[model samples]
Target: MNILYIVGEFPKLSQTFILNQITGLIDAGHHVTVLAKKSESNHKIHEDVSKYHLLDHVIYYDENGRDSKFFKGLTFIKSIFSFGYSQLLHKNHPIHLSWKVLLSSPNLILLYNRLKKEPLLDIDVVHAHFGPNGLLAHRLIQMGLIRGQLFTTFHGYDMLRFIKQKGDDVYTDLFQSKTVLLPISNFWKRKLEGMGANPARTIVHHMGIDVDKFEYHPIKMSQDIKIMSIARFVEKKGLIYGIQAVSKLIKKGYNITYSMIGGGPLEKEFRSMISNEGLEDHIRLLGWKTQEQVIEIMKESHVVLLPSVTSHDGDMEGIPVILMEAMAMGKIVVSTYHSGIPELIEHGVNGFLVEERNVDELVHTLADIFSLEDSISISKQARETVLNQYNIDKLNRRLIDTFERKTH
Candidate 1:
């Protein structure tokens, strides 16, 4: 099958879940072409990105002149001359598109040109990873610029934060169209339905990790516990709560070393909190690392801490892939009961969970984990959970089956 993947950023280090699916499809003998407005100019990328030669199949479109009205007019005129007026003025190609589409994609002419060129023909499934990209791709398909059965995957921000900012009717047209809606979890499926997505078409499709890459390590008793967190320093991550819990554990005289990976807006704030609590010696902020580096760190660490919470602005998580990755590797994951996390983690069963932003509970959970003489059974269960459900190879086959079923 020929697949077209529409995304905001290409080759992003954090969104390895999407990359896993793309590479999995290619490994299964399906051709995939990635379309993005701009490329991610990162120095480090996941190994599979280069291993699969994914950059060779990537096509970038222009996002240069969407803000200014004068520039928009110039691009519109340029598009007419470059691609001919007949295609632009087609019945499905509305001259007066929604303000959002027109404003965001003023250079649609550039996208049409790139997609129509060689090596991008016969799109069987248009798999868009976010709401905005789906919206844009829906417009292109309507204009007869691309051909496929549109399928949009709603990951966190697109359903929660985006709807809060754009209102409930933001996806009305796309939902009403033949686009099949896929939310990463039941939590998101309900939210999408509440916001007017067709219940019959909306399905829960989780993002998965490459389980084979993360080797399981048995829990070994140690006096000094090594904990780690890999997340952007954002409000929804509730990273500050994790930091406070770590500090309290230190105060109780539990030898701990917490290493935080990734960087974002709240770095300075977290640094200040660490200094105020005198936890600078215990907690270290080790910025962004490549996928290989993260896996190596996970092998050394005993606990994976991710305390997620609903941000003040209505932002939430869509069942973080890091949690699944940790579970797949037989690590004791300590997260929260936020969003779709409970769907993935059953407290005291496969992994542990606490209330969102509860510092005391987090500290208690850590202490309990440390007190346990043997956690090998729970670790085994954690590894089994992901092996059965969150494995990328299995999920990709399921995704392809859905695509075939829908397209036929």
Candidate 2:
């Protein structure tokens, strides 16, 4: 099957889940063409991006005219000439697009230009990664610029924070037009249903980690504990709380080292807070490591800590893939019972889960893991959880089957 993946950023360091899906599908004998709004940061990308040569199959467009309007106009005119005005205009257009939808054409003028040269009308599925991308794809389909069964996956911010800001009706058109709605967690599957998504069309499909890539090694008890977090420095991550918890533990005379991987808007503020708290020596903020680097870090660390919490604006995590990766690596994980995290982590079973912002509880959980005799057993259970449920190859095959069934 030929699938076109619509996304906000192509080959992003943070969105390895999407990349995994793309490459997984390709490996499973499907053609995937990526359509991204923009190429993301220059930070080192996942090795799979190069290994799979994914950039070759990508089509990029400017979101807000970071490129000149004159160039876009030229591209649009060129597309019209190449495809012929009648074909591009669609003489018997399938849907009646609104003025607002027509207005969004310029953002996709470059894509239209590519379509003129190599039209994707034969594509079986047009799957968008987020709500906004789904809306964009809906507009294109409405304009008769693309022809495929539409599907959208609603991840954390797109459904929670975005809808909170844009209102419940934000996804009304997409919900009505899309053939399927995939939410990464049951938490979000309910949210989509509440926001008017058809219950029949919605499916809870988790973003999975490639368990094979993350080689599992039983965690060993050590005097000097190494705690690590691999997440964007954002409000919802509650990284500041992690820092505070680590500081409290240090003051209480725990021999521990904390390492933070990934970078975001809150980096400067986090750095300042770490300096002010005099934890520069104990906590290391290593910004934006590649996928390979992260796996290596996970292998060395005793416990993975992700103190995720609901941000002020209601942004939250939808079961972070990093936790899945750590669990797959047979590392004990300590995260919060926020959003869909509890679904992945069972408190005192496979892994430990504390309340959202309870630093003391987080400290206690970390301390317990350090001293517990059955730490290795718990870590093995963590790996078992990932292998049983969150395995990428299995999830991707399920996704492909769903796509085939829905499109047919």
lDDT tens digits by residue: candidate 2, 12-122: 888989998999999998999988878886667788998999999988766443567677667656655655555545647454444344444565556555454556687
Per-candidate alpha-carbon RMSD to the true structure: 2.6, 3.2
Candidate 2 wrongly placed segments (more than 4 Å): 63-96, 102-118
Candidate 2 residue 387 C-alpha distance from true site, Å: 0.5
Top candidate, metric lDDT:
1
Candidate 2, residue 69: how far the Cα is off, in Å: 9.6
lDDT of each: 0.86, 0.84
Best prediction by TM-score = 1
Query: CA lDDT of 332 in candidate 2?
Result: 88
